[model samples]
Target: MASNLPAPEGVEIQEQPTAGAWGEWNPTEDSVRPVRGKHRVAKQRGGLARSSTVLGVGVIAAVGASGIATAQDRPQVTISLPSLPDLMTGGDSGHGGAGDNGRQTDGGSDAEAGTAVRTGVIPRQSDHRADAGEVLRNRILQQAESQQGAAEAQARAEAERTAREAAAQEAKDKVEAARKAAEAAAAEAAAKAEQEAKEAREAAEAKAEQERLAQQSGSYSLPTSAYTLTSHYGDSGSMWSSGHHTGLDFAAPTGTPAKAVAAGKITSAGWSGAYGYRIVLELEDGTEVWYCHLSSMSVTSGSVAPGETIGRVGATGNVTGPHLHLEVRKGGSTIDPLAWLESKGLNV
Candidate 1:
């Protein structure tokens, strides 16, 4: 028994009979089958083109994702630093980053950049502090030098003043010594002058006393009676061998009164050889007057007055005749009676 199968829509059905079998067989076609030769090769080429297109799309999508991630990270790349405005204006704003200036850039992390800026600014501040210290040291040294100079000058001035004072005191002492020497010289000169004046006065007084004594010794007066000179003093004749008169002979008559010629005391009233009754009278100045050749004596010794009768004239001894022999003497020397008597304003 063989039977015919019904065919489906848009398909042809075919069957094959089995040998020695009684049934017809219909084989199902495979949905995936190996194409033969050139048809398989053509199908492989189409599959390769589709795979290259898918790979190109995937590479493009990966590049687009990398660009988007880079965009998002742009705002996060921060650099913190000091800004120009902050430095110039001395602002208190604490915020610092690359956003402040678009032109400025940094190669380090945020903290590292900030530390570099701070280190860079420290050198300028330290330099200013060093300069101030140097100025202060110089001022201190200059002030010390000035003070030392002033002290030295003051010491020098004091030394000069002391030297000047010593010189002035020495000069004053010298002047005082000279003044005392001059005063002593003046006193010595005055004393010498006074001594000389006293000597001159003594000499004048001695000369006056000598003149007064000479005047007293030369004065006398003579007795008055009528007489004649017979033998004079110093006359030589044959009456004596020596040819000299020993006494003055006055020729007068006997009994002729003899008078005293000066005021005196009668020192002698007696007789003697070559003179009859001789009488000697001593005057007030110690001079002797003799009346000789007297015949008689009226006044005695120690009694006589001026112009008083002392004796009576006569030739008593060694006489030729009656006459008077008169003599005058001062001290011990015989002198001419006429001349001595005339000097006292009397005439024989």
Candidate 2:
């Protein structure tokens, strides 16, 4: 700041400057450092820079708030900026002192103002800092809760899907198992039926073969052919010796064939007094069959099968006509010959 005051009465005025005088301002790192958050000024010259940063931010905020209020009421409006000199030199033409209210009178000199920038204007004030901080903290907590809820929902959905899949798999396995079980049961039933059928067929074939052998072997047969039953055992008759008949008589023509009733060996072949020219056939069960009044003997010895011809019918015994008198004896005792033959599956 160059002085325009006149030199005191030409006392060889010097161009050299004296003490406590301002110089041309060139900002340096020592005179001013960059302002960040808080309004701070260097001690080198009583903090002239403090007015710009804090005051500028406060003014911008106030203008912005007024603009919002004006737009709500009507439409957009512009605010003109102050002259650079007025802002820099901290002067308002309407006031007389530069101590306050962004005002200075008659361009007050630096010496009178005491600083290059006025420190009069105060920034907007807030009652407390915790209100803003608390709002931010609440927003953060709400965001965290929302994220956690979303994660829990996703986990529940995944669990439900997994459970459904597992249930479906279990049902499929049960169906497969049931199918296999049904197949096994069917196979077992078929095998059992087949085995039963096979056993039944074998039993039928065996029975048929047995019947065929019974026919071939002549298991039981009548004693003589072309005969009539003339006398029965236990008949009331006076035959001189016992007064009752002891044998059943089968009357036939002379020399008619007399056959063995069952398979046996010939035990006797000679005549007795009353049953003359008789033949005795002893069966395998030890029952003896007597063929009486035979005209001639054929199987007189050794073995003979059932229905084999062993003699011819005759009347050489007692007073009987041409007939076969058959008598059956068991355990050396006599049984009715007709009843014995009937018990052997023969109706004679």
10-117 per-residue lDDT for model 2 (tens digits): 111112133556443333343234332222211112333324333433433454555532112221121112222333434333443334444433324322222322
Q: Model 2, which residues run further than 4 Å from truth?
A: 1-169, 172-180, 183-191, 194-208, 211-215, 218-222, 227-255, 261-264, 270-278, 283-299, 302-308, 314-348
Number of the top-ranking candidate, with TM-score as the measure: 2
Give per-residue lDDT, candidate 1, residue 12: 26
TM-scores, all models, native as reference: 0.36, 0.40
How far out, in Å, is residue 241 in model 2? Answer: 14
Worst 10 residues of 2 by lDDT: 70-79
As for model 1, its CA RMSD to the true structure in angstroms is 34.9
How far out, in Å, is residue 139 in model 2? 4.1
RMSD in angstroms, all models?
34.9, 17.0
